[model samples]
Target: MHEKTIAELAAALQAREVSSVELTEHYLRRIETLDDALNGYITVTAEQALEAARAADEARAQGRAGPLTGVPVAHKDIFCTEGVRTSCGSRMLDNFVAPYDAGVVERFKAAGCPVLGKTNMDEFAMGSSNETSYYGPVKNPWDTERVPGGSSGGSAAVVAARLAPGATGTDTGGSIRQPAALTGITGLKPTYGRVSRWGMVAFASSLDQGGPMARTAEDCALLLNVMAGFDRRDSTSLERPGEDFTTALDRPVKGLRVGLPKPFFGEGMAPAVARVLEEAIDHYRGLGVEFREVDLPNAGLAVPAYYVVAPAECSSNLARFDGVRYGYRCEDPRDLLDLYTRSRGEGFGAEVQRRIMVGTYALSAGYFDAYYLKAQKIRRLIADDFARAFQEVDVLLGPTTPDTAFRLGEKTDDPVSMYLSDIYTIAVNLAGLPGMSLPAGLADGLPVGMQLIGNYFDEARLLGMAHQYQMGTEWHRMAPGGFN
Candidate 1:
């Protein structure tokens, strides 16, 4: 049951072979046994889960279940849940429990999915590695010594280890896809406005978008059907019609034009990772998917621009964590200055503090135009590069990360190196485009992901391609040796 995909669980529920309550209990028990070592969950809502599962069971008995009814899924701790601690992986919000559910949580509950837990993440969604979490780092399922990527590391690790069938993740820079890549799971980061941000803690507002993470792209599609929609509360939320993401899973990829951006395959990429991507492109070619050469000249500038823009937005977005409102306050303070500085100093971890400082500096009066404004202009150029590539191809293909999962503390010392881990994924966010990562191949006995970027609102096509690849390969089905 642990190895079964979310889609498989849904089918079992529909067939009456399993009850939602039973499924939810199974996952809860697994969390108890396995999560202590992984440190994946920050909060486990046992009572709420039981209640939700009971309701799903009742709905299933009445034959009123949705496709995802009764499936247990985890949520990233960053998403607010009424009466549940939504810490955003920061000590500042260690005691902050929201009064309302996040848009994603509401959607999942409405679809009759049971909550498994709130997974850990990078503090304020600020790091490429989960080490920035106030709770602690989430261990990679593949190799416990290696890190599960951030800021969705816990979510990715849970799904990869079969702790939950699927989980929700947010991507601002490569949060969703990078961790999924490292952990051997599939994840999607939709277009900028596709998923509502209401109740989801903001990191870099303009670049933030939430999506699904699962063992297979088909499951991601099923989850996305419920996850994507219009919400008035989120001003940036798209006012587009709902989509059936699973509709085209069986669609043929014959004659599909796959664009291979030369820059993504250039120097600095690990030879093993480059080989895997080359193999993936060849596999696509065998499926009659055509490959074309495309150049994203400004691709190299993505990391620098993202560093400036993401931190600047994060600085502004995180200012709300003052001691006055909900979240951690100083034990005692002599004055207002003491209150502000002490609360923040104790509340934020080293990495979170670093990003806040960098963001604040970039947006400061003297540096705003030089750093923030220039980064924004460069962001436009990156988007333009994608625009030109999409004009020639239906989808773009590349390695999700430069390498597989690294040892837990490998890059923690050098912030610049840590920032570069998101080099491939940040560009998609900068362009406001939809991107999905599928298990491409393996390197060093660990999984590597192949990323597919599509034009805005082209999630369906991306899923279709991923589904086709999964059908022809078994990469997504493989889990860690101990877990299996």
Candidate 2:
């Protein structure tokens, strides 16, 4: 029962083969027994989860349950849950319990999905590795010595370990997809504005988008159906017509053209990782899918522009965390400046400070026009490159990360090496296109993922393609050895 996918669990619930309470307890016990080592959860709301499960059982009795009525899912700590500590992996918000639910949380509750708890993240969603998390790094279930790629590391780890069947994660420059690739799970980051960001603590507003993470693309589609919708509370939420991401999961991939960008497969990619990706493409070709050589001319520049633009936006978005607001404050204050400096310095972790400083420097008076403005212009070019490539193919494909999970502290001292891990994924965010990472194969006994990028608002098509492949292969069914 614990090893079942969310869709399988839903079927079990619909047939009364298992009660929501039983499912909830099954996971609660898993978390209690397994979480000590992974450190995936920051706050486990046992009482709240059981109460919601009981309510779901009552709804089932009344014949009013929805598709996800009895499912248990967790949120990345970045999303504000009414009474839970919505710490965005920062000590500043360590004591700050949100007074309201994030738009995503309300929707999940409205659909009768049980809230498990808040999962850990990189402080303010700032790092590629999970090491930036103040709560401590989340361990990769595959090799406990390796990191669960982050800033949504905790979400990826828990879902991989079966702490929850599915979970929510946010991606601002590969935060979600990279983790999914490393942790060997399926995760999606919808086109910007597809998911409401209201009540989701902001990191880089232009790049932040939340979506679902699960063991299979089909399950991801089911979760995305509920996750995506317009909300008046989120000024940036897309007002477009609703979509049913799962409707096309069984659609045939025959004749669909997949574009392989030249730069993505070029220099610096690991040989073992490259071979696995080639095998994946060959497998897709066996499915009758055609491939083309496409060039994203500006794809190679995503890192530099992302560094400038994301931080500039973050510097502005994070200004609200001063001592006076709802988060952590100085223990004592001599004056306003002292209070501000002490609170900020005491609360933020080292990587968070690094990004904040980098952002601040980029946005400073003389540098803004030179750095921030130039980066935004390059961003437009990056988006243009993707738009042009889509005209030549149905979806774009590539490796999700350069390598599998690295051991803890391997790249912590060198930030550039850490940032480069997102080389293949950051462009998707810069283009504001929907992207997903599916477990394609293994490299050196560690998971290697194949990333799919679809045209804007083409999440359904992407999921369909991923689902088709998952049906044809067993990669998605494989989990960390001891997790079962």
Candidate 3:
């Protein structure tokens, strides 16, 4: 039961071959037995899960079950789950239990899916690797000593290990796709505004978008069907017509035009990862797909521009967590100033503080024009580059990361190198385009992911392409040794 995909589990429930309770119990047991070493989940809502499962079973009997009825899933800790701790993997919110469900969580609940629990993430979704998670880093299932990519690492790790068939994740400059690539799973970052940000802890508001993570593209489409929609509550939500993401999975890729960004294939990629991506390109060519070199000349500016814009936005969004209203507070204060200083100093981790300071400096009165404004201009250039490239291709393809998973603690000291881990993925967010990562092959025994970048709101096409590739390959089906 734990080994099945979300679709398979739903089928079993509809056939009455297994009860929702049985499925829930199986996953709960897996989480209990295997999660200690991985530290993938920050919380486990066993009692709540059983109750939800019982309700799903009742709903099935009444003919009121939805498409995802009785399907259990995991939510990233950054999402608010009513009455469950939505700590965002930070000490500041360690004791903060949300009073409301995030928009994505609500949709899943409406679909009758039971929540497995919250998965750990980087402190406020700030790190490339999961090391910054206050709860502890989530270990990659493929190799325990290696790091799972962040800030969706926990969600990716659990899904990769078969602890959950699918999970929710947020992408802010490659949070979802990068980790999915490292863990050998599928993750999607929908076009900005396709999904609501309501109740999701803000991180670089302009770049953050919620999406799905799972073992396969077919599963991601199903999850996205529930996750994507307009919300009046979130001003950033787009009022676009709803889409059935899974509908495109059956489409053939006979003449799909895929663009390979020249910048993506340039210097810096590890030889092994490049080899795997080359093999993926060969596989796609065999599928009757045509590949062409497209220029995203300003793509080279993505990293620098993103570091400025993201932190600037994050600085503004995180300002709400002061010592006064909620979250962590100093036990005693010498004065109000001391309370504010001590509380924040103790609450935020080193990485979070580093970003906050950098953001504050960038947005400061004297530096605004010199730093933030210039970064925004560079951002426009990057987006224009994507716009020009799309005119000649149906989709853009590239390696999701420069390399496969590195050992934990390997790049923590060099923040610059750590930031570059997202070199291939950050530009998509800057352009507000939909991007996805699918397992391509292994490099040095570690999973490598090939990314697909789509035009705005063109996720269906990306899903279709991925599903087609999956049909002819076994990468997504291969599980880690002990996980089985």
Candidate 4:
């Protein structure tokens, strides 16, 4: 049961081979026995999951089951689940309980998927490694001593370790794809505004977009069908009609044009990861796909620009967390100023504070034009570069991260080095493009992933291409030793 994909599980449920209650109990037991070492989940809602599963079983008995009925999944802690603790992996909101479900949560519940629990994440989705999470770092399932990439590391780890068939994740500059790359799973980040963000704790409003993570692209498609929809409450939500993300899964790749970014193939990429990506490209080539080299002239500036834009938005979004309202507060305050200062200082972790300070400084009166404005201009250049490249190619291909998963604590002390971990993925968010990472192969026993970027609203093509590649390789089928 643990080894099956969501589609397979759904098929079994339809066939009456197993009950939703049985499937739910199976995963709950796995969490109880294996999650201590991984620390992949912040809260496990076993009772709620069982109750949902029971309802699903009744629906199935009544012949009203949906495609995803009874499928169990975990939500990234950043998404609010009414009556459940949506901590966002921060001490600041450790005691916070949402009064309503996030738009993504409501959609999944409507689809009949059981909510497993909320997975751990970087504090307010601020870090590259899961080490910055308030509930301690999530360990990579492949090697316990290695780090799982963040801020969606917990979601990636849970899916990679088979703790859940699928999970929800947000990518504000590679949180979903980076972790998915390191952990050897399929993760997707839809075009900005393609998915609703209401009730999802803001990290950076412009960059934060929720998507799906799972062992295979097919599973990701199934999950995205429920997650992508417009919500009137979220101003950024796209008003496009609903889509069947899996519609193109079986599309032929013959004559498909794939663009390889010259910048991505240059320096900073590990030789092993590069070699694996080349092999994957060759596999695609054999399928009659044509590859061409393209240039993203401003790609080099993406990191600095993202740091500025993301943090600035984060500063504005997180301003609502002052002790006067909700979330954590100091036990005693001498004055109003003391209450705000102490509550935030004591509640937020070092990384969160670092980003907030950087963001606040960037948005400050004197530096706003010099820093923030310039960064936004550079962001436009990056988006324009992708726009130009897409005119010649159907999709862009590259390595997901510069390297495979690093050992835990290897880059923690050097913030610059840590930030560079996402060097390959940040530009996609800057451009609001649809992107995905699929397992390519293993290098030194750790997984390597190949990334695919598509034009705006081109997710079906991205998922279809990834699914085709997965059909020709066994990388997505490989699981961590003990977990399987």
- Candidate 3 local Cα displacement, residue 61, angstroms: 1.2
TM-score per model over all chains: 0.99, 0.99, 0.99, 0.99
Q: In candidate 4, how many clashes are counted?
A: 0
Residue runs of model 1 more than 4 Å from their true location after superposition: none
Q: What RMSD does each model have against the real structure?
A: 0.9, 0.8, 0.7, 0.6
lDDT for model 2 comes to: 0.92
Cα lDDT of candidate 4 equals 0.95
lDDT of each: 0.92, 0.92, 0.94, 0.95
Ten contiguous residues with the weakest lDDT in model 2: 440-449
Q: For residues 263-345, write the lDDT of model 3, one tens digit per residue.
A: 99998799999999999999999999999999999998999999999888888888888889879997888998899889999
Clashing pairs in 3: none
For model 2, the stretches where C-alpha displacement exceeds 4 angstroms are none
- In candidate 4, what are the lDDT values of residues 294-385, reduced to their tens digit? 99999999999999999899989988889887899998899999999999999999988988899999999999999999999999999999
What order do you get sorting by lDDT, best first? 4, 3, 2, 1
| Model 1 steric clash total | 0
Q: How many steric clashes between backbone atoms does each model show?
A: 0, 0, 0, 0
**Candidate 2 global Cα RMSD:** 0.8
